[model samples]
Target: MNFETVAPNAVPEGAPLIDVREQNEWDAGHAATAQHLPASTLMENLDQLPETDDPLYIVCRSGGRSFQVAQWLNGNGFEAINVAGGMDMWFESGLPIVSDGEGEAYVL
Candidate 1:
């Protein structure tokens, strides 16, 4: 099934960018505005997401997992967009990213 997609740099400001990577990946680095929501726990934490009329963006180390999450969200009646190319692209695009430490981390 095809879900919506948005380029990493095209994600709108203030949109809920749910990072579906594991906690370690999240701790390493993530979009400055992204929310930590590992795909493993997404279904269980659905209620914790922000209420938005616009499509929510899903991101992972690469595009694969987030694409799956986007498909699941769409099937569940939630508008979701997979961030094509994911965090790697986000970092390549020079977007602001936050990390627990000062050093850079791998995206995938």
Candidate 2:
């Protein structure tokens, strides 16, 4: 699978930053602008992915899940980018994480 590393600020304005982590981890912290769509739900929700030309940035607490999701997207013809550091890397970089809001939904 094709994969590129995307730094925290590299995300485009108004782009969908997909968080592929579990619910509890997401509740603890995540990119403020990221949308929760765990890896397990990715294939089932391919229709919701952003346009093919735009980035479908996938992230996880660490890097494992995002890699899987990235591979899946790439295999399916989407340009998938992996947030190399994921949430842990983001936190280590001193970036901020937002609380889960009403619009947030967790994957099983």
Candidate 3:
């Protein structure tokens, strides 16, 4: 399966941002506009995926899980790309994140 991989800053504005991290990580912090679809629950919720010709952006704590998800989505006919440095890099790059709990938002 072939798919593109790009850094956090390179993800297109308003592209479907899929957060493949688990709930705990998501609760800690995630891109303000990201959709949480933890890799573990992805298959069951595949129907919820957005419809778009533009590439779907997948992110995890680091890059591993997102890479796997991007491959899977690509195999399933969606144009998906792995966010190369994942949430860590996104946070480091000063991107906005949302936190459900107390304290400063952090990439988990």
Question: Model 1, range 29-95, lDDT digits (tens) per residue?
Answer: 8888888889999889999888989888999987999999999999998989999998999989888
- lDDT at position 64, candidate 2: 78
Residue 49 CA error for candidate 1 (Å)? 1.3
Q: Considering every candidate listed, which one attains the maximal lDDT?
A: 3
lDDT of 1: 0.87
Please give, for residues 4-25, the per-residue lDDT of candidate 3 as tens digits: 8999999889989999999999
Instruction: List, residue by residue over 1-108, the lDDT tens digit for candidate 2.
Output: 457878766767677788988777787678778888877776787777666568788889777789788877888778888888678777777776776655443322
lDDT, model 2, position 44: 84
Model 1 TM-score? 0.91
Q: What C-alpha lDDT values do all the predictions have?
A: 0.87, 0.75, 0.92
Measured with C-alpha atoms, the lDDT of residue 36 in candidate 1 is 88
Q: Which stretches of candidate 1 lie over 4 Å from their true place?
A: 105-108
State which candidate, 2 or 3, has the greater TM-score: 3
